[model samples]
Target: MFMNWRRIRKWHFLRLISMCCVVSLLMVCWEHVDHHVVSHMKSYSYRYMINSFSFVNKSLSVSQEEAARFNSFPYLLNQNNVCKDKDVLLLLFVKSSPENFERRQAIRSTWGNESYVSHELGVILKVVFVMGVHTDVTNSFLLQDLHEEHKNYGDLVQQEFLDTFHNLTIKLLLQFRWMHENCAHARFMMSADDDVFVHMPNLVRYLQDLRRRNVRDHWVGHVHRGAPPIRSKNSKYFMPFDMYQWNSYPDYTAGAGYVISGDVAAKIYQATLSLNASMYIDDVFMGICAIAAGVSPQEHVYFSGEGRTPYHPCIYEKMITSHGHENDIRYLWKAATAPEVQGISSGLVGKLYCTAVKMMLLCKPYFSNTYSCMAAFT
Candidate 1:
């Protein structure tokens, strides 16, 4: 035993340290493999691109800087500075033309008749996208406040008429945040673009069910492990950052997406107050705000960007909402209320053929102005 101890003591301390180092490295690699599995979504490259932009120099003018900083990417905004009631789920839209909204109303009156606006369902307080609005949209934003005899709106009505609107992504959040702070009776808030075709009736059902389960978490159209941010001017919305400095962000539901629960929205809004803007669009902004808020984003699996698909086979599934392109808002109504499919098999996923062409012909006369969809679209 004494001879064996002598041999063991003879080993070099440096050799022992090297062995320990190798073991530590292997353990780290193993732990990482076990804990941080990579996912197969196509967005990983975009994530990498965004991180690269962080290395760029930040050298824009103060005014231009503010414009550039807030302008960011993906969604545009009007310069209007305003406040909204907290109790309402504000649906903000940015259009090159506000006049188009009038025509949109015509489209709604003509075909919106088929929309599902149930009392217990999701609700929207649609507003102009800030970018498209005049530089002073904020003055108009105070319409509900100027007539203070009836109401007194706060934060949203900031002191700026020339101020460009916050990004739709940010504006929606701003609206919700302003309201939560202002409205006491308000229980929840959601922000979505005008283009998104939301299934309000189903959303209401989901919310009611969620409430029963006592769940209060923020949900967005969720993407699991988004790759690094990609920086490209051609893409409408781009991200520029390393896999965010943090290991992960609460999966972000895109800004065209919505937020739920007044408290979480409020918390996120507060989280964003001091958060410096990021290079990527909504998702990055959301990542920063979520991180600042310390509120982990919960992925609501039902959210989709598939548009009319919202009304298809998943029609019976639980859905908070989904995304649709700016041009296809009316298409959703047409797809959902197609009288022919009331009880038939789910036909929304089928190929668009001559019938679709015929539908367009029927819809052309009235919709030609600003309307889209076949005559039978709604």
Candidate 2:
């Protein structure tokens, strides 16, 4: 019995040693692959990562050398051939889908084809909407609420959706350089989704007001306080259930709508070169870059999301552009703009909005140049 017990103990000990050796080997191999290989996916130097699932379909990752191209990013920023023209150029990037034709039509209807509406405040600027397309039709992980029949023919949305969007984002810069010079926009570049309903006239007026004041940090949009990018499957930009043992989104960009000043755009484009990177929720990625580039994320009075959250009628009067959630729109339009439901835009409400602005500012200084994120910009 004693001899048998000794032999069994020896066997178990040997098995444990073998397991440790295997684990150590895996760790080394993984480190080697990550360090030697994963850094080269971007044609420009910033590290760009799409989901690993893309590995099975096509080996899509940027090489380190390609990422190195951005060392002179801002310095090499392609200025417009006609850079001297002082005009406003509106850059709108739309996430295109076939099902969104009506929404697209609504946007076109809202703005009309001319792209710019010149008003006394300023040239409403030549608008260039670079639709960020996600339409290939072979996606396996894409999700859309079949809630609307209109959004039926959606884009091929998989991990590839992220990859394609990022690539297009980079390529669009080329288009921006060409257009920026010809049109001569002085104030801003607004990047956003197709679903966003920008109160264009209102935005232009606000920007004009800012320009007269010489406020340079213009990456302005609705700010989600303490909002972080989510990493669970519940999130649109989720990782695999077992892949990462972490939760929460890094401080990131909201996908709805954001406007960055042309100077800041040039800075962000440059800062992309020096940073260690983050994953592909473009908003968050942009936010990360902004933080690195001495840019501050400003929360405006009007942006919002997640249909559950809506702006009360009292809330909308002073707001610049509300995110048009259907429940809110379907009813509010009825109350204010539509025929019957009266009393939407109330009078004493203006008083409440002005009061709130002051109160909110007193508590937390308004996000003006006087109050910047420079101390904690990164």
Candidate 3:
């Protein structure tokens, strides 16, 4: 009887200790937990309310005088003749840093080869690299090299601004401004990073279909909906209250790569003129501009977010853009555009095999940032 009483006492003591520890842990982590979970919920609710009432445009509006300074930088290097005599189908603007010469070359030799695209796809796709001058004084020598490169390729579009992370919105302005002035008649325009891998054939086919259907106001990519702003100072994308007090950013596509029809591109350009460009995060600024123009982004499963897609024939068969391909672009271009990739989805057996392969690759408890699991069935 004595031992039974002691056992019960010990069990109660342990339970009390466990409960105390759990409570202490919760107390210690409450701030962090609240910041992430509760803050996000509040942000989502607020975003939904504002979006439903169509108040985003008014909330993000800026004075016209302030907006005039956004795209006022003069062009140091310009190409006014890229789409001169061609019925251009796609005007692709590659956002490259001044020092990414190697990446530009790799693209030229691989999927961005204009000659290959014209011969194979029988469509006029113009690829132009947009950039700002290097800020570092030591890298001043690169200016001559850049000029020579532009002279050689005639595809570089540069402006007189420092190439810094905060100036991404400036670069964004450059693309649309150039398109508005020069390539206004192109059917579609694509903005992409130098490191992104674009499967030219698949993209051409998709755009061709859209053109046939006369799709307007079309902007498609990997969409981020209800994304909360990063408040931590350590984050590169941190948004301060003074900059953007909003809890959630308007729905925007990832800046790594995205496509817009010619009409939509024009609308975005006009929106930039009126909306504030001080929101230096280019993609978020794009969302604000899109909201002002009454345009919404369309999500495509094949468009990757910040992460690269898994390497497989099944993925290659449908991929539009894969981010973070700084090194293996050549090899990936060869493998992804191989003739056999077409055969992998031809007949019933091949289709089943690819579908099963995609399911295994994409269906995971954790998100892959690439294609969603539903892409396997499609």
Best by lDDT: 3
Q: Against the hidden true structure, what lDDT does model 1 obtain?
A: 0.43
Query: Arrange candidates by lDDT, highest first: which order?
Result: 3, 2, 1
> For model 3, which pairs clash?
none
Residue 237, candidate 2: Cα error in Å is 2.4
Compared with the true structure, model 2 gives a TM-score of 0.53
Per-model TM against the reference: 0.51, 0.53, 0.91
Local distance difference test scores for all models: 0.43, 0.45, 0.90
Tens digits of lDDT, candidate 3, 12-123: 9999999999999989999988887888787777766544554666666778778878888998898898898799999999999999999999999998999999999999
Error of 3 at 69 (Å): 0.5
Winning candidate number (TM-score): 3
Q: What's the CA error at residue 107 for candidate 2, in Å?
A: 0.8
Candidate 1: where is the Cα deviation over 4 Å? 1-99, 102-132, 135-173, 238-250, 278-280, 306-320, 325-331, 334-378
Clashing pairs counted in every model: 46, 14, 0
